[model samples]
Target: MPPRSGSRAKSTGTDFRAVEPAPLILLKGSEDYVATRALDRVKAELKSRHPELEYTRLDVSAATPGELSTLASPSLFGEPRLILAEDLAQMNDTFLGEALQFLEEPADADVTLIFRHSGGNRGKKLLDALGAKAVVVDCAPVKSDNDKLDFLRQEFRAAARTIHPDAARALVAAAGSTLSDLGSAAQQLMRDITGDITAEEVDKYFGGRVEASAFKVADAAFEGRTEAATRLYRHAVATGVSPVAITAALARKGRQIAALVDHRGPQNQLASALGLPPWQLRQAAETARRWSPRAAADAVEAVAQADAEVKGLSRAPEYAVEKAIGRVSASING
Candidate 1:
């Protein structure tokens, strides 16, 4: 959830992220629909806490910046209001100036401001200021393959349906990664299956789930017991996880560990800041403990080189990923 800055609207009840500096951020990199859905969930949570909260929704392209700046003003009803700045970056500078000023003080109107920016940091100075006065979050995009799989798992869980991992992957592949496609597929599958969405059902409705060619590459790279990292790199290339994805993941994880070590920040807070789900933190902590800062730095460099090779230097992704992972695991485990 993004940061939101507003006074306690004196609702009967609500959980508006009791964080000190509230900056309502739509997750960076998430599809607009997915981000919006996340915002909706936050609203639901808040509603549960404050039943009398009011809402004002505006289209980004249509609403000028002035309108956004004033979104939090108190109304005659005296109820706390929430403003949805949809597609905020679409507005012109005429509105941006006023918007930034409003963010500076953001009156005590018993309202919360939700600013959603796409990845680019256009007019971000004000956002930076908000970070000090409110919460600042970067909602990054999710990977198509893994992200979709995660989304499916979440959806199925919500619907009280259990889908095999393979089944869930198939749905994502066939349905495409877009929300419209995935959501429609899920709804139809639920209707058809009427209960548990099994692998057999996936085969029936979404077609047979074929082996993902990238698995061999991913599996071999992680096993650490072999020199097959290079071999699997070739297989990953044959399929479509993208060679860069493999290298990037290794580099990203290494960098994350390094950040944790260097900052020595609070464990739970660091995990939240790093965006790891609660479950992954312990394993990551253990990994960090065993890894010297220098080793982690070298591993990050190796991954960077591999990323350049596979993504920019025309090297085979399999070779790049294989080599990068081997070096990383060696350093991490050594």
Candidate 2:
């Protein structure tokens, strides 16, 4: 029998960290770092109080409605249980109905249910309904460099370690900006070197991730380092770097080169006009020397196309980015 919708309580807010686990939890978003940490915290808290936990992981895609009904039903012994339901988008109609029905009634206080969702168009109806009642945790993906740096700061602080600000940026540069990689790097650094970490230490130890920043990739592409830039692009993408970020970097670099190529004035005046720092203007001038004005225009056009492709206009975003890299490299070298 379906339970009444208004019979059970709704969620107070989206602050999952403070809230005790309600009967339903909707862990939504693409940021694995935030979501995973929250899930771990919940499990740790639950297990600490109840040493013997009845945890069940559900596969809604394959499990029949009958199986789900049996699993979520009140146990005879009334043991505290933790139910984890993943890939909500893949559930069949019958299983979806059964799951929604279960949420209508208040579960035994001891039973906690967590639903893991990787954000997409699928399961919109279920998500909208669950948002009202489920303790919603937003694990939205962190795409910008600054946000990733902030994440590193918090992670390091959590371990009672104070990392220098420059060191945090250095870590992002060296570790490819992904939360998991950054977290691992933080632990490794803290373990190997006692006390506060510095940028020099990050460069010395974890230099691999830093070796391929978006700007560096753009520099290589514009400087006609075809092999090098292409390799860096692949590494960045694999390490969860956003394609949009890469395109933005390329566009910025292209504009700098264009400005340098067209400007005819005192160095300071040109720098002011282009809004580039002295060091950056010098670097752009050097790169611009290698490419003709026509080539610079071509590079700019390529970046624009790549931008469109990555924003969902093209089916293959990664390839589109790579192609843009190749075009820019070829133009500069031409």
Candidate 3:
């Protein structure tokens, strides 16, 4: 986890572009997107160095004993080889025994072995051995919104394009939480939109997507824009947005405001303590300033009622959500 060359790159995060071809490289984690990207980077690097590189992909689960040794052994053509051994987490005993043996005396400099293990304790011994010898690339899950935003930013930066923060946020909200979807959406925007991407452009492209609409309603409600919140909530329902989704967004916003309402620490410390990104914490703090403790409590109750109603407690889910929006807005105003 060395810092990448660029100033914008994170020191602790893996930069696939900076990954060099090693005798043993481990792409470890359950995040397929990251592992795939890291593997691609390694392949690209090796391909650049040796245009006639012999690439072989082996399914470790199906591989036989001594198969790795046979592949890693020098070929007749003398071409440098890159062996990608995948599914190490489900590796067979034959492959495991041979892999451990192979590690004792690794392949020649001309042959590189790349292993992909997608979590679990399937082959802890081999994993431990590989951990000691391999150049490990973490493919951990990107779960939080903050991490997703960072990913979107990286995607834009890598393309030599810039995205406005609001634009990034809008894209994340609209694209949902899937990394692949976000990547695809970002790629589409980068290819279609000229210059720096704006919030207007993201809305123009994905305005019909209802995922962001719920959050938009919550935002307006928290800001005391009752009319705007009501309008947005109605429009979201019209566009087929789920009432549960709206309630979930409102609950999340309520929690953010509640967390910040009585917080009495430095902003940075609070952000870290709450596992919130600084930007999100700052936004929550701004909204929290207008909210008394009682108002915050009332908003929580309102969101809970809406949550229950949306999940089969009320006959008219739409009305329940609208009522919650009104309560939130009232709390904000008072």
Off by over 4 Å in 2: 1-20, 191-194, 209-334
lDDT of 3 by residue, 104-195 (tens): 76247788888988889998998877776677887778866567778888888888899976567667667745777778789899999787
| Model 3, backbone clash pairs (residues 3+ apart or across chains), number | 0
lDDT of 1 at 150: 68
lDDT of each: 0.58, 0.76, 0.80
State the weakest 10-residue window (summed lDDT) of model 3.
Answer: 3-12
- Please, what are the lDDT tens digits per residue for candidate 1 over residues 1-334? 2323452222211122222223343334436655565567667766776689888776756656468656666577877777766555575675567666665553554666666666566657755554454433334555555566666777777777787654565466445446656767887888777656643355456542223333333334433434665655555445544554455445445656787667665778876666555555665666577667888787778877876786558546556667777886677566
**lDDT, model 3, position 50:** 92
Query: lDDT winner among the candidates?
Result: 3
- Model 3 TM: 0.64
Tens-digit lDDT string for candidate 2 (167-199): 665577667457778777888999998878865
Ranking by lDDT: 3, 2, 1
Q: Report the C-alpha displacement of residue 219, candidate 1, in angstroms.
A: 25
